[model samples]
Target chain A: MDISNLLKICIKALLNNKMRCFLTMLGIIIGVASVIAMLAIGNGSKQSIRAEIGSMGSNMIMISPGNGRFGGVRQSGSSMQTLKLSDYESIVRQASYIDKITPTVQSSGQAVKGAKNTPTSIYGVNEQYLDIRGYEIASGSCFTESDILHANKVCIVGQTVVNELFSDGTDPLGQTIRFGKIPMKIIGVLASKGYNSMGQDQDDLLIAPYTTVQKRVLAINYIQGITASALSEEYTDQAIDEITKILQTNHNIRIGQDNDFNVRSQQEMMETMSSVMDMLTVLLAAVAGISLIVGGIGIMNIMYVSVTERTREIGLRMSIGAKGRQILLQFLIESIIISVAGGLIGVVLGVAAAKIIALFGTPTAVSTFSIVLSFLVCVFTGVFFGWYPARKAAGLNPIDALRYE
Target chain B: MNEIIRLEQIKREFIVGEEVVRALRGVSFTITQGEFVTIMGTSGSGKSTLLNILGCLDVATSGEYYLDGVSVRQMSKNDRATLRNRKIGFIFQNYNLLPKTTSIENVELPLMYNRHVSHSERRERAIAALKEVGLGDRLTHRSNQLSGGQMQRVAIARALVNDPVIILADEATGNLDTRTSYEVLALFQRLHRDGRTILFVTHNPELASFSSRTITLRDGRITSDIRNDRIASAAEVLAAMPKEEEE
Candidate 1:
């Protein structure tokens, strides 16, 4: 039979039994709606994690001073101040994958500018630290290499610090900020970067030259961490390899002894975060799949009832001239009409649900791939559930069916 | 006239509980092309069984049934359906037109089963069939909207839509009033005049008198076969009938 004619018949048949059809389609509706909503939520969570890790920095490798350990056991601290300004100098000279390196020292204290005073963390580094960490200078120049060599206590304040300290929008240049009884001159301001993935206030900070922080502020640091950039994103692994080899040779730690510091790239961080989200996505999809199976079962039950109710009609059609496959096609088409219609309606409801969730301050994303996949699953459910009842109807003998009063 | 259908020693047995009950036993008959034949019998006299076999709705347990020179026993269920669709049209006593279906759509049902007819052509043929049944104005009326006689007419139109050579009607007038029955018989007469072969099954002898040939069945066997030289015309039978007086 032609599909168009079968479709018309199926539609008319469904229209005649509107209540029954709607009841039958409800299962598919719920299935599709849940699938769409769950997928959207899962994708939203994944994207959030990626964004959080990305905010840390792109291609910025961290070389923390520690021996890599498995489980909870620590074999060694491994480094005796092998990571210093001279070592940073050697990395920039010898490593082909080195982009920029920054030696950092940090201190936390109350910083005062004018009458406004707020307790916040302060970081001391050269100009390269900003580029390595993917931070942009919002308004003023960064602490230069010359300033670091001169041990000039000039500082760059973050936007949050500026808001807390200077509300008049007045240029804070040439102004002195007191931190730990030491007054520092402000030279520039950092741009606002509201929060990172972990909800950390990225804009609440103070930046100053590393030499001043080491000599005058923190006073006892052998460099906490060395932040380095790769020549390109593709060379991150190579950059890590070069940094590890140089650090090992300079520290004179041979194989079998753990290296002094660990080099970790942004891509590794992103992969770890994405793998966790992938697991979550799979779990959500599995739950959605269970609901879809329930939906298929619902379709099967409805179709069985329909076949039994229309036994006389089946007989009549058979006696007239319809083949078994014709009857099968008719019932199958009816089931498909119900399923596909439910799927479409469910998609609309699901997208609306996503929007509502988003409006409630939760992120949601409904991709076209998910929509198309849900629709196809609906159709597949129809066919899968429709087969049994259709076969039963087609296998009915016309003589017995007609005799069925 | 050449024989259009032949049944030789046909037997049909049904398993009722543990025992087998024979519905039709060694029934043999031959019907010529364009002949109007009626099978007359009481309830459970195998008349319906014979009709079912002839209409390809059931296969005989032991029989050699031929339609248009092809042995029906050799054909599969699907092939039988094709033959029924192409050559035999059936009219049931209950007027089994699906409820909520328009008269035109009911009439077009057979043509829809036949894939050779396009949608537009099926509609045209269904309309023409309704017109032939004098229901040109009521083509859009659903089965429930029509009276018993009108519904039966719609059923007849459906049976005739495919232009089959043979029409198998089972108790065609059993549910109608005498006057409506006469009207239906008159319609059958018009169809017969157009050279269509018909096999009607009924218990009413009055209905059998309209056909040129009548076969009487008793206890699953043919008891009598008689051919009438002159059958009463449907109009003559209606003319001799008493009229209902208006209040």
Candidate 2:
């Protein structure tokens, strides 16, 4: 018989035993739904961790000075500045994966604005520094490249510095402040970052053009460090590789020699944050897999009983001219219909359950991958578990089957 | 008359533990088209064995059997199943109507295995068969909702739906009361009058009077094969019964 007719026959048979079909399907429904719901919650936590890391600039790469052996002399860390303006310029010229790059130079001193003074560090940065460090300007604008080239004595003060310097509610924009001996013009106020996980206030710093800090405050032509960001989090490793290649080439380092700088991306910190989430994901998968197996076992058990119960029916069909293969198809299709229908209902229930969980604020995210994966798994489970019973139905002798009570 | 079935020295055996019980020793018979033949025997007379081989539900250990001019002796199991589907109809003692299934669907069961019968055609034939058996209005009724006589009519409709070459009835009326049995037997007699070949296997000796021919088996052997000059009308016998016991 044609497949459509066979399908109709199988469907009719299943409908004849609706209660049994439904009870058999319940196991699969629970399995698929639980798998989807658990995965949604697991994926949600993973996404949240990614977002938290993203907030700290996940792709941010910090190129800092490292130990280096120059021809005859070994200059370790602080004894020599390994990063240079030439190295930074070469990285900018050659790197393709980097989205943003900034040169940084640092100096700390007592900052004064009229009567108030605060011991704070002043950061030397350009226009790209805010984007690289995920910092925002509350008002006004950053110091331009023109300020860097001209060594303009312009700076942006953080919220804490603004509070310390102008406690009387006086706006600090366009006001002049002194860092050690250098007098700087405040052009912008940094947005408040509150305190970090380390309990350190992040808004107690000032930012100026790197050239201004290098030429006026420190009187140095070399850069202290370089900060950059990849085009996206996916390209962080490639971006680091590009930066390392350019820096090592500019430094004249041999193949076996250690580079004069270290490229540290926040990707490392993201890894440490993922361990607990990974454990939860694995636990969920294990529970879901075990339930699916149990559901498969339920299908197998029901199919065995169904074959036994329908023995006379099978014999009658065979007597009326049904091939053994046709009998097998009928039973197998019945099982597959049960499982696939259960899977469809489970998908709906799972998504609804995720939404319900989301309403409780656990942050469930149902992805298309989990749905497709669960669907394929259930179909496979049906076929795998339904095989033996269908074979048993197909292999029955018509004489015995017709005579079966 | 065209010969519809020809059997030559058919034999069947079963291995029960270490002992082999010979069910059919050597049985031979030929049935023509439009013949109503009753195979009569007591239990263990090999009547059921002969019926099974004739229905193609079981193969003989050593025999040459032909149905509708096709050799069934050496045919494969699948081929035999197809042959049975196209050439055989079966009516059982219990009616064997699929539970919770409508009468029309039960009638459609045989045609389901025939790929040439389309869905609409299948329905048309099932309705036609049910209507023929006086179950036209009960087409949608399930097995449990039907009376015993009505269920047998439905089974007869199922048997007639596929229009096979020969209809095989194994104690078709064994489970019914005398009135219902006569009602079913009358239906069979009408089918016989309509020129359909029939093989009725029954242990009841009185039931053999309704058929045109009777073959008696004893100890896996046919003891008598008689052609009855006068066939009894089951409908008349049913009508002559007491009217107060009809319900």
Candidate 3:
């Protein structure tokens, strides 16, 4: 028989038992919908994570003073002071992959202004620190080359620092706030950066020229670390390589000896985060896949029952010159129609569910691959689950089937 | 009359769990075209077995059975199904119309299995057959909505749609009341007058009086075959019977 004729017959039979057909399709519907939605949520979160990491100075590199230990003595990068201003200057002059550079020295202390005090860390950096570290100034201007040359006590404060040190909501620009007895004039107020992905408050810091912190606050000659931004994200690795070569040669550390400073880039962190997200997406999709499999089983189950229930119908068709293969094809076509129809509805519902989830502020991305996969899977499930029962119907003796009550 | 069926010692056996139950021991008969023949027998007299064999639903274990000059005894199941599709129509006792399906669709069923029939042609044939069975106005009525006699007419229309050489009906009137049964029998008589070959299987001896010929079976074998010199008209009998009580 031709497909369309067979299709009409099967459709008529399914419609004769509409409730049974719909219940059978429900399994595949839920299965496919969940699979699509799960994959979308997973992929969505993965992309958002990448965007979040990219927001945090995606091409920025940091040269710390040390790598935790040297000669069995615990030497932290924050306190080692192996990084120097000369090394930073050498990289700025020689490195071609990086477009911006900054020398940084941090000192933590309680800032006081008219008896209202709050503890905050002060980072000493050059004019390019704001651009390199993804910081934007809300008011006033950045510290200039002239300010660093004279070691000016001018600084930029974050929103949290402003909230803590200033009692009233008055303009703190050009006003001096003391960081442990050293009164520094506020040149600019850094824009608010609510929080990072790690749940760390980003708007809780102070910035000044490295020269001032080095000479006046810490009384130190060597700088703590160096931070810089590559010309673009793609040049991050090359920029790190250039910085390492410049630092290694400047420190006069031989090839066999470990360099006293460590060079790191945001690209490394991005790769690690991406791998974790990929794993999570796969996990969610797999969990949703289980539902699809269960749906297939449900289809198989109903097909068997339908075969049993329609034994007399099978006999009638057989008596009317329907061969075993025709009967099998008819039943098989019925199941496939059920699953394919359910699959179509599922794709629509899944996209809708994902969109609904997106409305709640959760990221969701529906890929064509997921929809296609769901379709193919539901079809396969129909065939896989539908075969045995159809065969059972085909193998029946026409006489016995007709004689069946 | 052209020969439509030729049986040569047809035998069928069944192994009922270590017991050999011979359903049709040695049945031999020949039927020509345009004959309204009834095979009458009691339950367990192998009448059902003979009907199944005639419809090509079951193959005989031994002996030869030719249907419309085609060798059917040794034919494979699929080949027999094809022969049944092309040369035979079946009307069951239950009517067996697919529930919730329109009468026209039910009549269109047998034609669906034949690849030679196109969609529009199938519909045309189904409508024509239904109208032939006096169900022209009930073409779109679902199977459940039709009465017992109407359902049997739909079944008869379905059987005739494929233009089969012979129609095989097994206890077709068993499910109906006297009035409905006579109405269906009258319809069959009209088809017989139109030269349609028909085989009616039933246990009712009274049904044999309406047909032009009668065959009696007992103990899985044919006991008697007789050609009626005087055929009782089902239309006259139905007209003379008391009218049905309308609800």
Query: Chain A structural similarity (TM-score) per candidate?
Result: 0.93, 0.67, 0.88
The prediction achieving the highest DockQ against the true structure is 3
- TM-score for each model: 0.91, 0.80, 0.89
Please give me the DockQ of candidate 3 compared with the native complex: 0.80
lDDT of the candidates, in the order given: 0.87, 0.90, 0.90
The TM-score between candidate 2 and the true structure equals 0.80
- Model 3 chain B is weakest, by summed lDDT over 10 consecutive residues, at B238-247
> In candidate 1, what are the lDDT values of residues A118-141, reduced to their tens digit?
998888787888887767887768
Report the C-alpha lDDT of model 3 over A1-405, residue by residue, as the tens digit: 788889888988899889989988998899899999999998888787777777778998988987646679987667686777888889989999988999899899988787788888899999998988789999999999999999999999999989987758889898899988899999999999777767677788889999999898899998988889999989998898888888889988888887788888888888888888889888888888898888889889999999989898899899888999999999898889999999999999999999999999899999999999999999998888889999999999988888788
Query: Is candidate 2 or 3 superior in TM-score?
Result: 3
Against the true structure, candidate 2 has what lDDT?
0.90
Worst lDDT run of 10 residues, candidate 3 chain A, spans A67-76
- Flag regions of model 3 displaced more than 4 Å: A65-99, A107-121, A136-141, A157-180, A188-195, A200-204, A217-222, A230-262, B16-20, B73-76
lDDT of each residue in A266-330, candidate 2, tens digit only? 88767866787778987997798789789989999999999999999998888889999999999
Clashing pairs in 2: none
Better of 1 and 2 by DockQ: 2
Give the clashing pairs for model 1. Answer: none
